[model samples]
Target: MILCCGEALIDMIPAPVQTGGTGYVPHSGGAVFNTAVALGRLDVPTGFLTGLSKDLFGEQLRETLGNSRVDTRFCILSDRPTTLAFVRLTDGHATYTFYDENTAGRSLFPDQLPDLPDEIGALYFGGISLISEPCADFYAALAMRDADERLIVMDPNIRAGFIRDEDRYRARLDAMIRRTGILKVSDEDLEWILPGPGPLDEKAGAIAARGPKIVIVTRGREGAFASFSDGTMVTAPARRVEVVDTVGAGDTFNAGVLAALASDGLLTRAGLEEIDGPRMKSALEHGARVAAVTVSRAGANPPWSHELSGPDPD
Candidate 1:
């Protein structure tokens, strides 16, 4: 089982206008939330750990998770309002403007964390959850204190505007990276975390030296690259598709990778490192293909297992 820990909130996306304009449409989203839902849709045994409000929006969010078959027994319900993010689409990409200060999700406490289940093979985390206060401390502690038996995957979905304190954000990110076993980040994320001149290979190598056994750097439509501790590196180009929106593509790609690993019994660190070149290539290709399906849709909708298993693009 793979457990995803982070914020689950409502995203107010722009509605397509038939009269040559744009309007807002609310959808359930949050980086980890999207990943968890995608994993659940793929028939992966997945759980989500986070705080939710008892408000109407929260109810809708919970219903969405349930529809996706994500286990939400660990979710905490609060009287506080649910977090909301306004999403704007431009050039096939979505930009989020969040409203999470003092919200229920950001108020998560360490004591609220559910016990790490023995069945859990991996723990996945990232996004604004690492930028908040008590919750940030809570997740950081989980990353540090958890035994190495379980694989810890982290994706630092960088949003510079949401991070008020640059120094604190960098420190927390570095700490999280050190604890992560499989670190998946985008090229934009690397630039935000480590801003400097030079090749990204050097940047990725520098990050790898900090600890993670594997690092994947996604380069949008150009494709993605992965570097392993064994000094093996591989790249997979993005699949061509008529992108409707790139909102949750990366998050769904993460789901695809985790789902593939879980299905193949590769959720453990040993299992991960044992993956051969062909298997690794397959995993990367599968991730890119899954992401392409997501990009071709609207909002955070990812492909189902049957959809992903269909024929590849010719």
Candidate 2:
């Protein structure tokens, strides 16, 4: 199983009302959560690990996971409230104003972390889970504990505004990065984490030195590229589709890449190290294909494995 570890929250997005202008509507979202949902829909045998509240919204989130077929066996339940993020989209890009004080997902601690089951083959980490408090450190400890065994995939999905202490967040992120075997990030994320004067590959190479054997940099509509420390590189262009909102595009893209890797029997530490140009291109194409369905939709809703197949003969 590919066990994703991170935040699960409610995204209140602006919606058109039946009789007037607009109102915010709740949706099950969070970068990591969306990826897990996408992976499950793609029949990836995925599971999610995070702190969950017993609140109404939390129950809704849990149900969404169940409906999507993502296992929630590792979720830590509490009476704490669920985190909420108000999303505003401008020209298809999303910005968030979060209300996350003392929430269940934000309050997790290292002591509450569950033991890694022997069945989990790949582990994923990223998003706000790498920025918050004791939970961030807990995730770091989790990563370090299994670094030598399972395949580790990470996407820092940095939101600079959410960070309260830059130094501490960067420190925690660096630790996780070193343990990551497959590191996926957006172009903007690469810029934020490696903010300096250098070529993109140079910056990527520095991060590769820290740990990862395979590094994927995604450039929205232009598609994504996968590079290795040995200098192997492959790029795939995004599929064209009418825009809706770009909320879960990247997360679904991550799911696609992971699913592709797993299907090709290339989801292990050795497989990542031995990845070549053709295998890397196949993964990138899968990510692009999956993400195309996401951007063409209304919200963060991802396509099921059946929906991802090409349309019946038109």
Candidate 3:
């Protein structure tokens, strides 16, 4: 099973109330949470590892997970307040304003972490968990500790707005990248991490040099590209769809890729290292398929396994 490690929070999404004015509505989401939900919905044997609260929103997040069939045995429960993200969408894009101080997901300590079960063949980490304080340090340490024992996948999912210390965050990110086996990235995320003066491949190469056997760079509607440590590369075109809002496109895409990898027996470190162009292409297709379903709807809701066989958006 793939264990997703990161934050869990409630997203206050904008909606049109009866007054014909905009108001906020709560939804269960967080980068890692979104991916875990997507994985479960796709019928992947997935579990979540994170700090969750006992608050109403937290309970709601928990219920969402349970409903989606995600294993929650690894969660560290607390009475701490749940993190809240107020998301604003312009056209079909999403931006956010977060109120995350001292929340359950952000205040995690290393001791709170449960010993990972051996059944977890791969671990996925990303989002604010890599930049948020005490928890960030704890997560980095956990990923580093298990780097050699299992497959490690990371999607920096960098949100420049949330980073508190540039140098320190960069150091933590670089360290995690070194330990990552499959580093899935968006073109935008790449610019944020490896800023300026070169092409996308060169930037990905720098990270690949640090360790990751395969670097997957996604370009929204254009498609995605994968760079291997062996110096080979491949690309996949994104599926066309009517985007309602891009709330959890990247996270669902991560789930799709993992699901595809798991189905192809390439969910392990050795399989990733030996991944070929066609296999990478097929995985990217899965990611695009899931993502297409996500943005075609409202909020961060991804497709159910059976939903994929339904009607087309366009």
Best by TM-score: 3
Q: List the residue pairs that clash in candidate 2.
A: none
lDDT of each: 0.85, 0.89, 0.90
Summarize candidate 2's per-residue lDDT along 138-170 as a digit string, tens digits. Answer: 888888888898888999899998899999998
lDDT of 1 at 47: 91
- Looking at model 1, residue 68 earns an lDDT score of 91
TM-score of each: 0.95, 0.96, 0.97
By lDDT rank, best first, the candidates go 3, 2, 1
- In angstroms, the error of model 3 at 192 is 1.8
Q: State in Å the error of residue 118, model 2.
A: 1.3
Error of 3 at 242 (Å): 1.1
Clashing pairs in 3: none
The global Cα lDDT (0 to 1) of model 1 is: 0.85
Tell me the deviation in Å of residue 135 in model 1. Answer: 1.6
Model 1 Cα lDDT, one tens digit per residue, 150-269: 788999898888877889889988988987888999998988777989777778877888988788889987888887766677888899999998889999998887777777888876
Q: Which regions of candidate 2 deviate over 4 angstroms?
A: 311-314
Residues 1-314 of candidate 3 have per-residue lDDT tens digits of: 99999999999998899989899999999999999999999999999988899999989999999999999998888889999999989998999898989989988887766788787889999998888999998899888888888899999899998887999999999889989999988898999887888999888888788899899999987889999887888888898878899999999999998998888777776666657888888888888999998999999999998987767444
Global fold similarity of model 3 (TM-score): 0.97
lDDT of 3 at 197: 82
Error of 1 at 62 (Å): 1.1
